[model samples]
Target: MNKFPNKIFDIVQEDLMAVEKELYSIIQSPVNLVNDISVHLVQAGGKRLRPALYLLCARGGNPDPSSELLPMAVAIELIHMATLVHDDVIDNADTRRGRPTANARWGNHSSVLTGDYLWAKAFSAIATGAKQNMLKILTDVISNMCEGEIIQLQEAFNAEQDEADYRLRVAQKTADFIAASCELGALTGGMDNRDVMQVREYGYAIGMAFQITDDILDITASAEQLGKPVGNDLRQGIVTLPAIYALKTSTHREELRRIIVNQNMSNDDVRRGLEILYETDAVEYSYTQVSKYLQHARNSLPITLNGPVREALLSIADFVGLRKY
Candidate 1:
């Protein structure tokens, strides 16, 4: 198969410079320490997809893009980055986006502090200028995000977890920000409630697909490609979709059971469990499920959107599930 860096990748490359500058402009800080830590992570590079989603949704509503969209973009990214840094600490991960994780580079204390700072900045941006309704939406979104993460932690290694539970977890953890980002963008576009809700649903579907694909790739993608070992979720005692499906069909269900339920599995035991997962079609099955969501996302797009900007957002939903990075 051809690699993922093609036309859609080119679109992101073309827009990245403007997006980067916009992010830099709003994330400024008088506190040198906070600025230093926050800038380090920001500069490290992310796909900028969350912020881009905001911009794209704005463009879709009105053909003209706005500089006013900058702070919102920056705010969304700051919130996203903060969550990631905190997640690395929670996961005890060493790398992100193929670079050393903030937690790894700056120690847990700095990582946590920096993450908190980002959260504060993101909230401040929303409270200061954005519409009150948008701010309220974001506040609720962040709270839901925290709830999702906590739920994931609670369900970790609970192999009895079902697909519905998996979908709910991802909806709360990953889809909320995505949905909010699109809604904020549409609001910025000056769209009415109905249009905003439709776009938000589109974003939510994309986010759900994105997270499900992520879970599948955690089992199927290689370390060089993933920036960490496959099965990182399993290592952290989180049983993802593949594991859940695999265990159902696993001939060695008892072995898998002992490891997941009892806890404290050796690295070798986890490795063997992963092998069993691969041997089954669990990864393939999950990918099939993700594809269905992606299709739903595409179908959910409003017919009103018809141009390069809308196409770009659609391309992104198509890209995320299949991309190597």
Candidate 2:
């Protein structure tokens, strides 16, 4: 547990419990398997970052707890969870958060159907308020996320992935979710166009930073800390920022590429590949790159935001950079 400077960290547990209860209620279905699969993954839990973004964005305008806001939080969480379930299937990951993945436990067919079910459930929640503009935005964000994943698969281990390509992919796949969460928050809080755009920009920058840090951690963090296997991205053949950096800058780039490209590498081969990344300081270099985005995120906040809420958002940007794993 990182000691977060923001008070949101203090209240995060309580808010998550609330969100979880609400999520459970919304997931109720006539089909027991869909309900079971969704709830299992939901309760298995991870950082509820998207919902927190939604809540913070809502609080920025009006600190009051509203019915609409809770549903929006739930919607964001379901979308996030749905993504995770689908991602594990795509990655063929056996475990997540130290437990068998939904795809592993319930089979890929069930997990895929469950993910689709949650997506529908999330849209139904969004439709409760049914702002056509908001729906359009959410739809666009989801579409972009899918496209990002597709592009990532296409680019995997190409040895030619650039900063621009990586940034664009992460922005759509990762940042869009955060942006949607923040935008939805502002929308429910009655923000105008300027504030909404500001929050969206803030989310995009921070989300990019977050994913970059995740890439670094994949190389640097221990499996215990990561709650999944280390080098998970590399294992999937998806080269992230650090891997791309090492490919460009490391003296051992050819050897590393050989290990990955040849496929069927042993654990020792993966270890050496990781060691090459460390020798070249790719992890540290990746952190430096992420810091630039974190700063950009801080600068993106609306001038109107100040006080604890402002500080909380800033702390979130920092937290994204500083996560140990």
Candidate 3:
């Protein structure tokens, strides 16, 4: 019942609630620890944007829920959840969505295994009835995500990274899964091949914009809004779009370099770094890039695709552009 920025969610409120139930049902494990950790992660809460997008696409063909869509939706969400738990372990993050992370509460060992269990469960859900192609898509997404994380680890604090490097990383780390979600949704929705391609492109563009906006918010939004520490990426030496732009454009490039390379920046240093980023207008520059991708996302949608679902998709696109958290 929580208000979402995208009106489409409100329109599909009942279906999303169903997805929430399915998510819980699918992740139930016989192992008490696995069940406890997975349940805690689910309770932590996320927008469920990935599954929502899937359901929207599926509804286009099968307005009344199909057996195929629910399992796919559950699988997508579980994959996303697995990433979050593992990401927390990698970052040594203590909190997520304003709750203690699995790693934080259960220790890294348990958390890693819990994350693995989630991954296994995700694939199991998919294997139940999904097509071979769908399995291939999911496998490729997992590979890309791992490669993205490895690339990010390799590039940490490397201020020399360019837009291409960032884009590739974003595509692997975030956009591919979103693209897969839309593609699979369209496929399940009985959309034609061309239309499915269009939706997939739209998902990819929006996914890029989503991550760029998230990176911007990491520097601009408060910790409470983020449900994680502000400037956490910078603190961890994970240079994002704003930092990349600031490195290229800011007058304080040398200072930024020193702080970033040291990788042990103090709070005051982060404050000053943010100031430099602001002065350099890196945030606004990133926003411009987000706008470019948003434009692409809109253009990718077929003009012939009309009605509430189409409108909802457009609305979600706009929401991505304007979202703060």
Q: Write model 3 residue lDDT over 1-325, tens digit each, in one string.
A: 1235646676567877887898789888788988899899888878888888888877755533546577788889999999999999999998877778899899999999988888888888878789888788889988999999999999987888888999999999999889999888888887888988998998999899999999999999888888888888888888999999999988889999887877778998888878888898899999999999999998998665678878888888888888888
Q: Cα RMSD for candidate 1?
A: 2.7
Q: Give the TM-score of candidate 3.
A: 0.95
Score each candidate by Cα lDDT.
0.79, 0.82, 0.86
Q: Which ten residues in a row have the lowest lDDT in candidate 2?
A: 1-10
Off by over 4 Å in 1: 1-16, 25-33, 63-67
For model 3, which pairs clash? Answer: none
Question: Which residue pairs of candidate 2 clash?
Answer: none
RMSD of each: 2.7, 2.2, 1.9
Highest-scoring model, lDDT: 3
Q: Per-prediction TM-score, please?
A: 0.91, 0.93, 0.95
Give a tens-digit lDDT track for model 2, residues 51-103: 88888887788644544566678888888888889999998989887788998
Name the best candidate (by TM-score).
Answer: 3
- Any runs in candidate 3 off by more than 4 Å, and if so which? 1-3, 62-67
